[model samples]
Target: MYARISSDVEGSGLEVTRQLEDCRKLANSLGWSVAEEYVDNDMSAYSGKRRPAYERMLADLRDGERDAVIVYHVDRLTRRPIELEQFLEALDAAKVRQVRFVVGDTDLSTGDGLMVVRILAAMAANESATKSRRVKRKMEQNAAASLPHGGYVRAFSYAEDKVTVIESEAVVIRQFAERFLAGESLRSLAAWLEDNEVATVAGKPWRTTTLRAVLASGRIAGLREHQGVIVGPAVWPAIISEEQHRRIRALMQQKAVSGRRAPRRYALSGLLRCGKCGHPLYSAARQTTRRYVCVSGPDHGGCGRLTVVAAPVEELIAKAVLYRLDTSELADALAGRTAQDEALAEVTEQLAGDRAQLEELATAYADRAITMRANG
Candidate 1:
């Protein structure tokens, strides 16, 4: 069986392991060999691009690699209509059968089988499209009312394991912004926090990951992000003002360009451009000071609307493009998933302790060797 569980199920019950188990059992019961498995991690079902595993699997079916392709569910294969059709056509051309959870043991190679499979695929596609429309409508409502639907805001505890606001974490985030706006470099902030022995949101000495995370966050500015889009009207109290949030974002934009270090520092150099003329808008420092400018109209003098303030635009861009990968449990069986994940928390705890002990022993041996060398 050519089995696939989209990246949405990476850590969930539909993980490759679970899907393999179910498919292996089903295939074995039917006296068939589970020849291969294909997995697409961190790839969204909504998009047709960048899914190598999905494409390869379709090609394999076309080349007669397997008599049937099995999945934990239909949506695990695809949610996009065009891509799904491409898959079905590949199957039809090859005259290969397919199986999914809903169609437990049915064959899809024969004419009758093909009709049933088509109906089910259509139903799955319709349901997926309907759900997609519903989600888009909800987000539109969010945008209209200025609510957070796209993961724009992140409280210290809110986005991580702790979904609720912890007062201490909020305080830490507020101080992070305060230090950021006071013209402290992220490196300096990290160093000072470490020297003074200040803890991060995760309660340890400062590091770049922990520092930049706070500075880039909009939670301090009373906004929230859902699925990479900015949403406001958070359920928790905010740590900083929307205006302060804008300033921090501006500072990030400035620092991203004008800092005196290695020279080639441009993120949106080739990606973003005028939606009208399709020219590029490069990121560069402002004056001798640190700031970036969007040079859309200067190239051709088309419209003045191409200019965006360095900071806020960068912040929005950062939130939008960075990672944007939350394929959250779309392939996992939602009904029985929570219990499986909850059971693994204890193992994570044990692994963390082992990691800490190993670090301490390594640190001690290095310190002892350095002292010996110095004394000698």
Candidate 2:
């Protein structure tokens, strides 16, 4: 039995320890010999790579070091169908039984096994996609509606953009912008808000994350939030001008890039050097393919280099990945490291603890055992 949990799933009663404990108890009563354990902590399930512990366990399974595999649930293993296919082939070849708390047992040889796995993976994928879509849609809607969706903040509230006497959080909004422009850090602003007992729309204490959202909020710039969307020219007045808003946005964008949250289309964006000159390569559109090009500009004495097609490089990468996604019986495949916690194991443990009490009541009800009546 092996257990794994991401950092997010730890310490809230979903720790990996709970999974192993239940599996260990079950293995003992079932006369099954426990083999080895693997633990992967603080790993992300969306990464599409193998955890070191998981990879080692898979290798052990192939090497005949383990006969049966137990997890709190199947999701603890993988949420990728292609990866599941690779593993199913290996387990089937070894005649290994994969037991999970929710489903009890899985036979990899049957179509039902793969179907069940596909469903779990699909559910996980759907959940992830839905979240991303929700956020994007919220931003777009906010922009179109001329409302402040409070970008980057979770359920943020507002009074008004700017005001003196009537219905406005303008005082706080202006303070946020001024502090940002004065080079006061977002963390420092969060502390200030907390010290002053400022609360978000949800009536929660201020946080660095919330402060960052406030500084980036277009609300002060006369934006409004409607249905998880942002719109402009709100019913409220502008606390800050568009130019000032841009400046704040630029600062936050810089911070996001520094924090590594910026979108990167290619992993090798800045690292790929020119084949001829030693200059950093830049991408260019060439028909259906992208080409890396380097030209010696005015500063470099106008020495030019010819562009090379990216087809060969891209083809090489695709081939390598396709080869890795192989399945048994010569079937084709394609595949992450993801974090999944086994909630079902806790259910199993709870059921076990109740089993004895339930059994006694069952016997009493069946009339096989007499229940002694206690006088009040």
Error of 1 at 301 (Å): 69
Tens-place lDDT per residue, model 1, 1-376, is 4445443321222456655666676667667776777776634544445767777888788888767777754556665434556877887888865554412223555444433333334334434333343467789999999987765434354555334667766666677688879976777667666667666545656655456656666655556766334577566556788788778766665654454433323323333556656554545565643343344321223333454445565456655533321234322321123324654334333333433332233232222322221111
Q: How big is the positional error of residue 254 in model 1, measured in Å on the Cα after superposition? A: 67
Off by over 4 Å in 2: 7-13, 102-105, 132-376
Per-residue lDDT value at 129 in model 1: 30
Encode model 2's per-residue lDDT on 334-373: one tens digit a residue.
Answer: 1111212235333333323333232222222221111111
Computed on alpha carbons, the lDDT of every model, listed in order, comes to: 0.51, 0.53
TM-score of each: 0.32, 0.35
Ten-residue stretch with the least lDDT total in model 2: 367-376
**What is the number of backbone collisions in each predicted candidate, taken in the order shown?**
15, 23
Which is the leading candidate under TM-score?
Answer: 2
TM-score, cand. 2 vs. native? 0.35
